[model samples]
Structure formats: structure tokens, C-alpha cells
Target chain A: MLTSAQLDKPIVDSDLQREIEHFLSYEAHLLDTNQLEAWDSLFTEDGMYWIPLEHGQEDPVGMVSIAYEDAILRDVRIRRLAERHAWSQQPPTISTHQVTNAIVTAHDPTAGTLTVRSRFQVVEWRKRNFLRHLAGGYVHDLIKIGEQWRIKLKRVDLVNCDGVHDNFELFV
Target chain B: MAEADPNWVERLVEPARVHKAVYTDQRVYDLEMERIFGQAWVFVGHESQVKEHGDCWSTMIGKEPVVMTRDSKGDIHVLYNRCPHKGAKLTAEGCTKHKPMFRCPYHAWMFRMDGSLVSVPHRHGYDGTSFDPDDPQFSMTPVARVENYRGFVFCSLSEEGPDLKTFLGGAITSMDNFVDRAPDGEIEVAGGVQRVMQRSNWKIFFENLNDTGHPIATHESSFLAARKTSKHKLGGEVPFQLHIIEGNGEAPEFWESLDLRAFDYGHSFMTAIFHAPKGKISEDYKAALDTAKGKEEADRIVSMNRHNTIIYPSCSPHTGFHQLRVIRPISINRTMVEIFTFNLKGTSEEYWQRTITYSNIVNSPSSTVMVDDVEVYERCQEGMESDGMDWISQHRGEGRDNLLDREIQSEGISEMPIRNQFRAWSHYMLGTPASIPTGGGDS
Candidate 1:
């Protein structure tokens, strides 16, 4: 459990901030290259990937969401992307995630937990001239395991999270 | 617009084959809006959506914007969203609690929740003019008919058609089972609505609701993914999340073993392939229902597990999961689906959470299972645009259907439901009186 004061305190260490920024950029590279399995490895065993359907939606269990996946569901999603019969991926979606404005919102070095917030815009295109622009804010909760950082929770708050969308085959 | 020849409908629809023009022609689509959607009973919203007095939820019936409101007396009404003054829309979108009355934003003209004109600013200026406040034209105009069956509200744009009950026909049992499974014999639309846009004809989505054959092929990617994950992690014992997705990969024999029933007015349903397995959630829910409605009634209610019940031209309700996917046709090539999850009144919080989970997994836009389904629908739409094929086949198990007095039942893999829908479609397109067949065993 994190205290309010701990969550509000920003990490002033420049080295830690650079490290977190590099980690996010690497994750974005994995997603853009469609290396979903490698991307999945960035999370802990019980990590969560959530996309709230409504703005400021607090609870995933009580409300519907664009996505709310634990490790098992994430595995299913990754596996589906590689299936030959996945008609939606017949012409696989190509996306370039531009992650910017990285900031270390909170850090508790003794607890091995750091919270980072960043803004991202993902431009995606697929066959049949289907193109979409997805812009959102990402809130990542990371925990240091030894010298390595693993994602505990990754929450995406899209500008149009609640708006009607076509198939969302790939991760944001 | 020139009048479409009556033969056009008959030429487009056959017993087991339909012309691609029925799906791709803009003229036919427009005629459908006037003939089919104009006369059929379309679902507006659930009564729970506007529970309190002065609560309003805006939705669409055909192309017309409609507002479902609850008056001060708690009576629900469905009125056109257009304000009588300057034709401005009453509400922008979504639900709002406008206590007492609704005020038009264009002018200060106010109207009761039931669409009765309340008052307008400077009313004396219109006393001698053509504007008459007493006339219904001066206020919001209500749809021809609005009816609620077990808290599910439906409205018809035309006044000459059959009532909601008659239009629902034998498919009303799905509604009964939905509410009856609730311990308190009711449900409320909880959790928020998830909307998805499909680049396909509305009827294509409707046909796929009872399409058991397509699941194995269309959803191979999703089911295979779930199977792989379950085998690797859970050691072959699939959990609830994977179970629903993997069920689509069932063999042809499994689909053939299930039952499919089609009724009048394009309504149909397929028996649930996956039952609520023996688990803590099922046990607790059953116990609650047993306590509320006695063991015998609870057993009966739980026994009627249905996968998707098509209300025809409006929505599909999954009674087993307490979710409704309402279909709103945007154009000949585009459609919008709004998914609403319902909470059974007396169930445990865990039980209601299952509804949310099922909806997010299977119905949400990002759902692995549904993305493939939407993809195929889009592919069908794209393929139909080509000039290569004139007719789409519906010949699977055509003559094998057992046509009873009231409903048509066939093998689970039959295309009887599609043919049955066209039967209603042709009837409506040709402007024939709808006569629901009566006399079948209530299975």
C-alpha cells in the first residue's frame, strides 16, 4: 500500500528519470515492432494492463473497460496476434508509438516502487486503408526487482476511451 | 423518391438465397428504413436506464433521435428528441436528470417529461398566430407506441403494426428467463455501456448472432489463443475467461447438438453452449435464487440458458450473462452496437462482476473474441461490394427445419434462422400484415 504523501513526492534524481524514460521507449519499440511476447516479458507475473472506458474511472471490477487484462488475458491476446487464421490480423496492423513527456511522478526507493506518467500518440494503419490516431496518457507503476524494473500496472487513459471504436486488435 | 416495385423485395429474398442487392443497394436500405424499421418494434432502452422521475436517456429509433424519459409520476415515455420550437434536439447525448420538465435550448420553451407543452417565453405573442400550444405539434411528439416487457422498453415508429407483445412472439421467453434468474425478479442496467462501430450492414451482424457455424472458423484465432494459454498455464483446466473464448472452437458436432429456434418478426435464439459450471459463484447465485423463488422455480429458471436472443432489428440479449447488445443502423454500410451490462437485483457483488467480466471479454471493442467477429462482418461487407457474386448462400439445412405451428426449430447448425428473418423481412418490405404463428411446444 502506498501512502498519499509517497505518491505525491516526485523523484528528483536525474539518473532514475533517464532510466525510466529509456524503459518506456524500449517498451514502445517492442510494441511497434509487434514483438508482443517480448513486451509481455516486461511485466511481472501478476501485472495488470488496463484501459478505462470512462474518464476518471476508478474501479475496473465494477465498471466496463476498453481493456482490463491480467497476465492470463495478456497471454491470450499475444497468442491471438500470431495466429494465421486471425482474420482481423490478416493484414496486420502497423503502429508507431511516440512516447513523450516522461516524468517520474512518484518514487519510494526503499519500497522499490516508482510511478511514471507519460503522454503517447500511436498512429496505426492496416489493410483496406484503415487508419486511426490514438492519443492517450499512460500511468505505469513499476517495481524494482534487483537491478531490473518490471511493470506492476499499466493504465492507459485515452482521450476518446469511451467513444465507439472499430476492432482494437493490437495493444495501444 | 420513386416507389420501389413490390417485386423487388420478392426478387431479392428467396427461401434459401438472397441477392446481394438486399445488402448493398442504397435504395433498398432506404426502403427498409421506411418499411421495416418504420413498422417493427425497436428496443429503445431498459426501464432501469431512466428509473427516477425526470430522468432521460437519448437513443435512436431508425434514423430518428429518441428520448426515453420518466415523468414526475414515474411513467416512462419515448418521444422524438426534436424540440417543437426551431427543431433543436432536446438532449445532446446520454442520460440526464432534468427534474420537472425539459427546456429547449433554442428558446425558453419548456415541456413536461411526457412531452406535453408546459410553457414558452412571451406566450401572448403567439396567441393570434398559427402556433397553437394546445396542439401536439407544439410539443415534443411521442413515438406511435412504446411498451415495456419486463422492464425492457421498445418503441415503434409506425402506428399500424402489431403491439410489442405480438411482435416479440415466442421470443418473449428469453425476457422472462432474464428477469426470472434475478433473485428479485428484476435487473438494472449497471456498469457503463460499451459502444463499438462495425463497418458492415446491420443485418449481417443480426444474422451472425445465431450463426453457430461461423464461430469455429471465424474465431479460430481467439479460441486458439485461449487454448494455448490454458494448456500452458492452467495445465488444461480452462478458467472462466478462457472457457468462454474456447467454447467457440467447439467441433461441428457440438454446434449440431444444440437447439436453434426462430419465431416471427425475425427473432431467434441458440441454446447456450457453455453452462454455468459448478463453482462458488454459481452455487451462491443458485442459493440466492432458490431462497427468493423456491427451489423448483429456481431450477426451472436456471435451466433455460440461452446464448443470444435476437429481438430483431434492434438488439440481442444474452440471458445467461445479463447483457444486451443494441444494434443501431447508421447507413447501408455502417452500424453501431451499444452493449449494456445488467445487474440482477439480489445477486452477490461477485456475481454482478462476472457480468462485467463477460462483457469486457466478449463484447468490448478490444475483446479478442469479438474483434474477429467484427472483422469477418467487415470482410463480408467488402466482399459483397464486388460484382462477382449475385447471391449469398443460406442453403445449409434448408428443408430440414421442423416448422411447428408457432416457431421454427432446426438443427443447431441450420440456416433456418436466417431464412426465418428473411421471411419476416419480405413480409415487412411488401407491407403485409404480420401474423405470428401459434401452436408449438414451449421447449
Candidate 2:
């Protein structure tokens, strides 16, 4: 009951799969390069970025998450990270992400929506701090709007989601 | 490091300042674990967490591992988590449900939910060996004292001390108000707990709870971000989420205008800086409260708005937001905080959702607001390692205390809460009871 979404695996053509892979890799590139505003534009207006505290947490409203951000919160975090007085970001965190294993989990041609699952490992570092290695899986629910793909939902599940953690200053 | 003199411990804290060693030294931290956490009433878990018989929740009181369990005949007990035989922890960490009895994984010794000996694996071998199952030492040993204050459970490691209510002193009103605000007059810990590991001393987090001076300087980035987001995104109308963040941006005069009250045993609370929010959700919650409780009583309950109520050395409860942060000191420079969000039993689902939202925004490790706070705490801890300074000031509003019956009242910006906490700290470390004034005027 607490597993990830149970969707039938659909065979997608090579071009569509390449496009999806490109979109995900571009998203990771934006994060790695600290292009937060560009990353913010990838989400639909009411889209959400969630990192559930518990594995297989179905309800964001009823259960707490490490992060369950809407557009406004994402903006607030981006703005804060850019602030000169953002002490936590003093020597801002730098990271590189490896996003692989892109698999198409679901497809809806009529609704122009697709679900892609991928695995990610991020090596994040800040000056005068320990280097953090974060491994998580991403579940992207994407929708096509006028030939552009926008994220409807991006769910990140860290391997150690339930463990005690230090400050997570940036979006995972 | 050399062993600290008893006289040095006495001199480390004064009426207006504390020595830097209190925050930086390993020896002092060892003493604190012994005197303060070992003797004081430490919060364990809420009764609601263990509602059914044979349900258990594992947690640590200071460094002592203990478990809270509900018995078959409907009783709550706090027992040491270690098995009596080979000293293995009886249960794994976190909560478990519907266990008929606690069975040791090592020797397979079984004990009842109330921690009485039920059976041992090799009965015939123990029969000739003078193994006394009836002896208390053979079973999972309970802690010295356990008390439940309106479903908030606490335990003391010492056999002698004030009872839980007496130790709580004037802080009981905040606890009372927490439950009374619930429409069903009952609240339960729900949602899941978020654990944040801090690279600073435990007292640094506790002191920041009532330290009215730091938010404006320490939280500038987050608050400014909130204000900027409000202006750009919502046409200057701050939503509830942004409002909580930008609230720290209130004028210093606004913070100074509120009231601060400090009790005897290191407990204190500041009056609400954010009033009962005016919105459709709040109005609906108020209406439910008015229905369950009388309108007048409900209004009274809502009027007792408070920011953070410090129960001293253990937990801080934000009654208005329905959140509790339990502090666990891991080492001299390491602390772990467990944040728990509560659900008012009879409130609408939207109201409960708001509680979860507040927890995510303000208390979670990923919170933009708390990131700055934690950063500042870490900076303070690191900066104190210098030999440059020897004392931390608690002298903001020293001589202006107005002594009430059992609490000391001061202006909002005063450091009286910190001073009052050290007063209790000195007493505990020096092996004396925290003396509370009996009458209204100064004694």
C-alpha cells in the first residue's frame, strides 16, 4: 500500500524517450548551475515539489514532508538563497547530479500527460562543511502544453527519508 | 581537559552572564547531563502515542534509553529499554503496536507490558540457579518517576524531586490552554515526527526559543525573502505561510511591547506576537470551538495566544501552532530536535492541514526560516571555541524584574528568561531545589 504509483509500463518510442531524458537532464543542469529561476519556470502554475518524510506517504496534507512546496514557497526559497544575508548559504552550496535510469511508467496521449521515473545521486559541498552524498529517486508527472513539457508533480524519495538530517538548505 | 572544580561550576553562571566553558567544554556538558537532565522531569512521549494495550514507543531521556508502554489492564509505564540479562535494548527505536509481551532477542526472556517478568527461555536451568523472577532486578526496570500531565508524559530519573506539576510551575497554564483550545477538549500527536540534527549545544536551541533579540538579525534573509515574495507574487497580501516567515520582521518595538514571564524551574513563555489569524479557516475553527465550548470560554481560550512555552531542558510547545519540539542533547556540541505536530480531535480537516503546513514551513530541517537560525547557532558554537571571549551576556534587562506569585515578569526583550534558567541550572548543579517565591512581592 505504501509503494510508489502502480502504473503499467508503456513502450514509448526512442524520440519521445530521448526528449524526456533531455528534459530531465536539463532540469538537473539548471539545479547544478544554480539557475533557480529557470528551474522554477519548469513547473506548472499549481505544480508541487514534494519530498515526503515517510516512505509511500500518500497524503501531503495529512502527513508531514521534508518539503511540500508550491510555487510561492519555491519562490521564497529561491529568493532567500540569493539573499546576501542568507547566512546558511554564506559560501553557497555547489553540487553535481547524476540522473539516470529514465523509464516511462505511464502515458496518456489524450491528456498529453506522462510519468517518468529516474534515479539520482547528488554530491553537494559547501566551503568549511562536510561533503554530503544524497541518493534519491525522482517521480515526475509531466504534462505537455503547446509543445512544451511542464512538471505537474515532482516527487523525490530519499533512501534515508526517515533518518535524522542536518539542514537541507536547497531543493533536493 | 582537566576536571572542573565544583567552585568553577558555581562561578560559571552569574546573575547576568555565563561562562563560555558552559557551552564549549566537555566536562561541563557531562555535568549538565548528570545534574540537569538526570534530575529534572524530562518529556518522554504523549499518551496518545500509546493508546492501545501493549503499544510501545522508544525514546531517550538525556542518554538513558527508555520505553513508554501501555499495559493490558490500561496503564501507562516508562521502563528502561535494556534487558535485565545481557543488557540488550528490548525494543527497536520508534513505535510498535500490539505486542503481547516484550521478548528479549538475546535470551528470549519475556516480560509483561508493565515490565514484570513473565517467563524465561530455559526454565529448568534457572530453577536450580537462584534466579528470582519475582525480583525487580530480573525484569525491565522502570524509571524513578513518571507522570502524565493532561496526556503529555514526562519522567524523572531521580527518586526525589518536585512532582511534574510543581516542577512545571506557572507554565501549566500554557499546557492547559493547549488542550482547551481543542474543540473536543482533547488533542493527539499525529502526522509524523521530523528530526533535525543540530551542530550546536542543546542550550543554544533552548535559549533561542525565548531569546527575542536574535530573530531580527539572525532571520533577516528568510524574512526579507518572505516580504519580497509577498510583494512580488501576491500584490502585497501576505498569505498565512508568508506571514509566519515575515513575522520576524516586525519592528523591534513590537517585540519589546509584548510580555515575558519566567517561572522558577527554567520555564518561561512570551506572549503571542502573531495574533489569532483572521481568515475563513480560523473563523470556521472558532465556530467549531464556540459550538463545543461556550462562546465566552472559547474566546478566552483563543485569547491566551503564546509564541513558545519552554518547559525547560526538554521540550518547547507552541500552543498556537499545535507543535511540540523535543530536545535531545547528543553531546557537548551536538543536539537533535524532534518536531511533532498535533491534531485537535474535533477540528475540521482544513484546520489540521494548516498545522501540517506550519510544521513544514517553520520547523522542518529544510525550512528556509530555520536554516538561518540553525546556521547562526552553529556559528555561535564555532565562534565560542576561540579563547577571545570568556562570557555570554544575559544582562539585557537585569534589575527590572517584577516578581509575581511564582514567576518573574519582564519586558519582552529582556534576558530574564535566560537568567531564570541559569538560576535553576545553578540550583540543580549545586544540588539544591529551585526556590520559588511564595508571595506576590519580592521575598
Candidate 3:
């Protein structure tokens, strides 16, 4: 039985797939380019950005999550990065995200959105010591606009989800 | 190098500040292992971690490998993770038991749940010798003292000292209200732990818990970044992330208005700048509380809002989120912080999500907010190693402290908490009047 509280499975049509690809690429471009201003456009007014601590974290309230960002926290991260005294970024962390394995798993027609999964390996070069690996699965919930799509929620599941991560300033 | 200086312990501590060598020096670190870690009531895992008869979690109190486990009779035990013979680690990390027995990997020596010697492979061979299984030397050595306050367990190696309740003193309200805030008056260790490695001394993190001055200067970048991101993303309408950032930029007057209480035994909790708010989360939780308990009791529970409560050198408990950050000093230069989230028993799903949400955004290792804070602590550490500086100042609003019985209250921006901690540190280092206060509360 499909209850009102139940979320419909997202549909992945060819055009929708193309739209998602464009949306993801745009989001990635904004992050890599340090264009946080434009990157913020992806989320809705009260949209959420969550990264689960474990593989399948059921609830964010009772359990600890790796990263939970509403609009404000995401903004703070962006602002901090752009600040002149972001000492950690004195030698800015250069990065190129190879977002691949783009597969549209489900679509919710009533909600006008779809759930897409992709494998991403973000190789970030910092300081001159070594490149850090941020290999993770990206779960994107995309909403349709007039002619484009916007991100409702983006959950990144890092391969090393529980490892001692240095600093994750850039959005995955 | 030269078998360590005997007088090094005496010279390591002073009233105001200790030398940087205390942090960076390996000699001092070893002595600290003996004096502090070897003797103090170090925190073991929470009771909920070992709910089942055989569940266990491995932890370190200074340089010792201690395993916290639950016995078959529902009693929790903290035992040294070693075999009586041949000296082998009894169990691996996160080991489970069939019943309540632990067998050593090397030599088949079995131990009971309460850390008593159970079996020996060559018992007949040693029958003629002075080998007795009942002897304390042959048995798995349990710690000298183990006590559980609320659901969290704490163990001390020293046979003589004040009990856990006395040692906790005025700051125990943090732990008490942590469980009391739950509708059913109980909390369970839920979710997983997030571990972060800090390249600074353990004291650095401890001091940062009550540090009000650093947020603006140290975390300015991250919070500022969060603000800009939120503003641009949400069309200048801020949410939780931005709220966290904006908290850092609170006026001096705002911070000064909040109370910072320092209790006996280096424990304390700061008044919240933003704790219980008129937000949807708090409102929903209040409703849940009203349903379970009366409105007055619920109001009282929520009103006891706090930021972080430092339980000395071990962990900091966030009463609001049902979370604890256990600080483990691995080396003089390296420290590991483990965050454990908990669930309020009999609370609605909304209440639990708030805790999880707080952990994800604030406590996580890769948190956008905490990364900058971590960086600056490392910066303080690196800078302290130079020959250029001697003392890190703690003279901020020092003399104007409000002393009420055993609890000292200071302005939020005051460094009284830091000085108060150093007083306890000096007492521990000098081994002066070496007795923890007895009775339930300090005051």
C-alpha cells in the first residue's frame, strides 16, 4: 500500500537522465570552480544535504550522521572557504571530481523528482604532500523546474565514511 | 634517554602554565601515563555498549588496554586486556562472546566475564608448582575501581581516592540531565562513532571545550563560509548551518551574559548561547515531553540547556544531543576524539533525528564547522614549539570570578575555566594533598 508518507520510486527516462547529468555536472562545476554563489542555487528554500555516518543510517535524529547540512551550514562552509584567512587553504586544495556510474534508479512522478546514484572519486591535491582519496557514492534527489532541475537533497557516501578525514571543505 | 629524570615530574607543572615540553616532550608523556592515566577515573565505554552478556569494547586508559564488558549477571566489568600467562591480548576490538567467557589467542587461558581466571591448559603439569587459579596474580586483573554514573561507565586504577560521584562534583548535572531530558528517563548508546585525529595535545582539545574567545578568530573562516553559502544558496535566508556560524559571531556582550561554571576536579559546563529555542525541533520535543511528563517538568528539563560539559581529561558530553566526545591522548603530539551519539528512550522519531542532525553537522570529523577549529588548535600546537614564546595567556577576565561555594562562575569570555583546570592539573602533577574529595557533590 502506497501511504501518503511513502515516497514514490523515481522514474529515470532518457531526457530525465540527460537533465540529471546536466544538473550534476553543473553542481560539480560550481564546487570545483569555487563558485559557491551559484552552487547555492541548487537547493530549495528548506532543502537538506546529508551524508550518512554508516551505509544505511535510518534516522538522522537518534543516530549520528557524518554530515548534515541545512542551508545555513552549507553557506558557512562556502563563506569560510572564500575567506582570505582560510589558512588550511593557503595552498588551495586543487581537485577534479570524476563523477561516473550515473544510473537513474527510481523516479517519483508525483513529487516531480528522481533518485540517481553515481560512483565518484574526488582526488584532491593539497599542500604538496599527497593526493587524498574521496571515493564515494552520490545519491541525488533532483526536482524539475521550468526547463531545468534543482537538487532537493544530495547524500554522499564516502568509501572511508568513518575514517579520520582531514577536512572536507568542498561539497562531495 | 638516560632512564628518565626522577625530578622531571616536580619541574613539569606550575600554578599558571606548564612548559610546552610537557606537551611535546616524550619523557613527560611517559610520566603522565603513570601519574594521570594510571591513576585517574578514566572513562570506559557506556553501559549500553555492552548490553548483551558478551558484548565488549576495547579502550585505553593512558597506556593500558582495558576491555569493558557486561557479565552474565548483568554487571559491567573493566579488566586489563591481558592474559595471566605468556602475556597475550585476550580479545580483539569489537569482539563478541558466545556466553561470557574470553579466551586468550596465544596460550589457551580462559577468563570469566568478571575477569577471573577460569582455565589453564597445563593445570595438571603445574599442580605440583605454586600455581593457583584463585590467586590474584594468575587471574585476569580487573581495574581497581569501576563505577557507572547514569549509563556511562568510568574506571580508575587507583585503590585510594574519592568515589566516582564525589569526583564528578557539580558538573554531574550535565550527565544527569542528559538522561533526564529523555522522556523515559533513560538513554541508549545508538548510532555509530566518528573518530577524528587531531595533531595537537589532548589538553588543547580540553581547553577548547570551554574556550569562548577562539570561535570568532579561529572558526571565522568555516562559519563565514557557511554564512556565505547559506545566504547565496537560500537567498539570504539562513538555517541551522548559518545559525551555527552566526553563533560564533555573537557580540561580546552576548557571550559575557552567559555563565561559565568551573567545578571541583577540573569539570565544568558553559551556559548555552543558543540551546533551547522556539524552533520546530524544540517545539516538537517539548510536545513529546508534555505527553510523557507534565508541562512543568518538561519545561524544567529543556531549560537546563548547555553547550559542552568537560568531564576532566577524558570526554565532553553534550547534554542536548545525547552525545559524548571521548578524548584519547595517543601521543604527546597526537590525540584522537571519538563521538558517540545516544537515543533518548521513549522519545518520538523527531527527537532522535535532532540528535543525529547535530552529530552529523557539528561533531563529525569532516564537519565543515569543526575543520577550521581543528586547524587552529594544530596551529597553536605548532606555534608553541618555537623558542619565541613561553606562556599561553589565561589572564582573560581572571580576577573577576564569582566564587559560590565549590562552583566558580565567570563570564563566558573569561579564561577562569582554563586557570581552574590548571589548578587541578598542578594538584595532579605535584601530587599535593593527594585525595579526591569525598561525598556526593563538591559544594
What's the candidate order when arranged by decreasing lDDT? 2, 1, 3
lDDT of 2 by residue, B370-432 (tens): 998888899999999888988898999998988888888999899988888888888888875
Q: lDDT, candidate 2, residue A158?
A: 94
- What is the Cα-based TM-score of model 2? 0.97
**lDDT (0 to 1) per candidate:** 0.90, 0.91, 0.77
Candidate with best TM-score: 2
Error of 3 at B24 (Å): 1.4
Where does candidate 3 stray beyond 4 Å?
A1-31, A36-49, A56-62, A70-72, A99-118, A128-131, A139-153, B1-8, B94-99, B103-109, B117-139, B225-241, B287-299, B434-443
**Each candidate's interface RMSD:** 0.7, 0.6, 2.3
- Residue B434, model 2: lDDT of 89
Residue B182 C-alpha lDDT in model 1: 91
Expressed as tens digits, the lDDT of each residue in B77-105 for candidate 1 is 99999988899998877888756688888
Query: How many backbone overlaps does candidate 2 show?
Result: 0
Scored by Cα lDDT, where does model 2 land?
A: 0.91
Model 2 residue pairs with clashes: none
